[model samples]
Target: MEGFPEKGIKMGNMTIKDIAKKCGVGVSTVSRAMNNHPDINPKTKELIMKTIEEFNYVPNNSARNLKRIQSKAIAVLVKGIGNTFFSDIVSGLERECQKKNYSCILQHVEEQEDELDIALHIIKEKKLQGLIFLGGSFSHPKEKMEQLEVPYVLSTIRTAGENCEQYAAVSVDDFKESYKMTEYLLQLGHERIAILTAPKEDESIGKLRLMGYAQALKDKKIPVQEELIGYMDAKKDRYSFQTGYKLTKELLKKTDFTALYATSDTLAIGACRALKEAGISVPDECSVAGFDGMEAGEFYIPSITTIRQPVEKIAKATAELLFDMIKGKEVPRQLVFEGELLERESTAFSSCHESVK
Candidate 1:
């Protein structure tokens, strides 16, 4: 057999022709061996492998992906990776993908409108087998995805004004969970409860959670006070600890609410800080609660009371649904998961009656 070149050149510059020459085999034989072709003899494949190692040959992703036809790789596109909620969803999706001997590719759009177009372009050009939209709103033309015949699922969040019946989704019953949490607060004798949320139309979560809050208060024979409700722009800034802090401060100034329910955990944490700094004790002077049971909530100075969504379960169910769709099996179009209320130090019965005395 021929010998490999000296180990001076970069591996990226190494090509199949170089490997074929060094192995004393045809380019086709080297190609077959690299791709694990059945026609190649074991001994010859073994010889090619040795030469490939010596030369440090690296396969070209673009060319190899084209020849494979089916990548056996799924793309998971989300709004942000830093969010704990999305991270749990990804962990769940990864578990199912690994079981089926498939790979998962994560992509984040950061809520930019143009990124959706780029994602659609990549799907069509790459011929990806499947796509999982984890979060964020995808408003691009659906005709492209439909024409490519690619199976796609929306997880954690659903597309508004789209025919959801035509696709599959895994999401929590936000409206129900929000309503339940509000009802719990009201049951504790909090008629002046405040709702802190982002804009309604931009995110379905905001709209649903706010509706639940309103419904619960109305059902309890309590008047819905406009001043007690807070709204912020969901797309204005990244959902961070600071956003929660600022919004909470504003809400506290706008209303004298005896209880506050933030739509997200981050917001709730911020609200807690603002309340403390303002000389108001949580669950005593004013009760506080939030959605999304983030890990940080457990260690918070006074652990936060919040709602917990089964993020892992949702991810696993989404992956299973996608797998079924790939195998031509008809699965349910929509799967709704329930939320659990985590009771902690941040919330308690209203102190309004005691203050009156």
Candidate 2:
């Protein structure tokens, strides 16, 4: 019920406190209203929002985040919002950040979003001390990499080109891990193994994983069937459960295989769902394997077989690497960890060994 601002002040100069003063409310009330908190009265929030709208008040994140020149905060930019595999990594990052007296901001980049562009904008706006890139295929040219001026670490993703030597990274050897999983499937006598993975053009982890799968097949004297490869749709969420489901359904229609290996645990679960709807028995009829070692895979209906990477260790290491680089304590480097393959309910020895191609 208070009066509005005078016509003289610049739009950007109006603060949340100014809005609160005009609304006869506290700054916290204005903040909760702006963010749509559940506990606020509908009418009060509506009034606050309308008052904010009338003034064209936009929060200046840069000013709010920076204490002086730095924010004391780090960002974890995850490429896909739907990937559950990144959840634990996020938690680990948050914990490590808190232990180091830094704030953590989690950001999600939609499927096919340009991560570097978004990251550059976020770093400027938030005055972030460093960045921890959680997912997405990073094969940026040096020009693009150089644009990200702040210290950053790539976790659980792959990067290529000579410019990668300039950044910090922590992850498993996707190529080696994939080879191990595929060889396990092959040892189970699965000659016609189908791989659900990233598109061929992907030059990151997806490419490495696919390479490992191909190498395992060649070593076993099994020709890599071109038709059996399941590539992710560019328009859909990559490394996602639904992507896995849809791709598996399409693969079933076009090819015949005794076993399936999904590049992620979420994808593996999706593949299992598709196989279930098709009335195909898991392990008994078709062995399935997954990567990422997410806990969800462990509790699923049949319990998934997967190559488990130490999520906490990798995440903490990623944080440590980024912080060290930011503090000028270390040079940018790639940290590789070993992955363990777990044999579980989702995979079994091929039932049709005699019928195998």
Candidate 3:
């Protein structure tokens, strides 16, 4: 029989550590191989599995619940339900989980719901090994975070008014990217530039982007006009197409500007629809630009000029950091990526600017 030795080891005598030692690999590596994680080298994984079978090793039972077998799984808390910008990031995270042989659970939190509370509940219910928070703002009290015993990462989201030293985060610098976009529009000779932004009370990336726009106008010696700034409704708008259209329509009724900068591609596309209905030509009568380069914006009739965030890079980094944390090989840290500006069809030199120059 090609199986256990004739002089068999006692049942449950071989622990994971013993298996790992027999396989000449780390405990984590052995665990990954046992779980069929793709990150492990194929030959090494085969060796580890063969050793496990030869040793008659059995995995440990979870202390949390004696009746249930603990799984190597993680959860991702997605704040915005229908936000397209988060779709690709979510998919990337799922792929990473597959490589690590961990199951990924995607849970969406409502606009007014508390994400941390949701996270705590899910961690307990699913016996999650780790977690990732995607989208939304995080400014919870330090003690609240302490309640989460499992390793976690903040992906594509910024914490406001918090000591970030104790958390791991992967994201683009929203303020810097927003500033770059605003400056680009300004250089195109748009003096009376308008912005479609987050609600006034927003404290996360929305607030950062808005600040970038204000600072850019200030640096240019252009007085910021309150009338030209459009704010979305917190209750009804989840950065959707309708929100963008509605905000632009309201801005059109109140002010006349040469350029419109939206904080997201979804909002920019919505603004374009509104502008089209009002008989204003994009880059002819008014220019439009956006942030978070979504695919829809690229194929729009008047392609959007926007800041393209490195979503795939951010997502991969987030998975690596979270896994490192879980392995006790890394401490809390922040990773900020730079965005690229793609100047496309929607923005151009202002007609008034040419006349003035």
Whole-model Cα lDDT of every candidate shown, in order: 0.77, 0.88, 0.87
Per-residue alpha-carbon lDDT of model 2 for 156-195, expressed as tens digits? 8867546666678899999999999999998888889999
Q: What is the lDDT of residue 22 in candidate 3?
A: 67
Tell me, by lDDT, which candidate is best. Answer: 2
Model 3 whole-model lDDT (C-alpha atoms):
0.87
Say what the RMSD of model 1 is: 5.9
Q: Pairs clashing in candidate 2?
A: none
Off by over 4 Å in 3: 1-71, 355-357
- For each candidate, C-alpha RMSD in Å? 5.9, 10.1, 6.3
Residue-level lDDT tens digits of model 3 in 1-357: 123333365645667777777678999999899777889999999999888777677776565345444557889999885889999899999999899877889999998788999999999999987999987767788899999989999998887566776788898888889889999988888999999987787877888898899999899999999999998777678777888899999999988999999999989999999999999999799999988888988999899999998989998999999989988998879999999999999999988889644
By summed lDDT, the worst window of 10 consecutive residues in model 1 runs over 1-10
Q: Over all chains combined, what TM-score does candidate 3 have?
A: 0.82
Which scores greater on TM-score, model 2 or model 3?
Answer: 3
CA displacement after TM-score superposition, residue 305 of candidate 3 (Å): 0.8
Better structure of 1 and 3 per lDDT: 3
TM-score of each: 0.76, 0.79, 0.82
- Tens digits of per-residue lDDT, candidate 1, 93-114, equal 9989998867788877765454
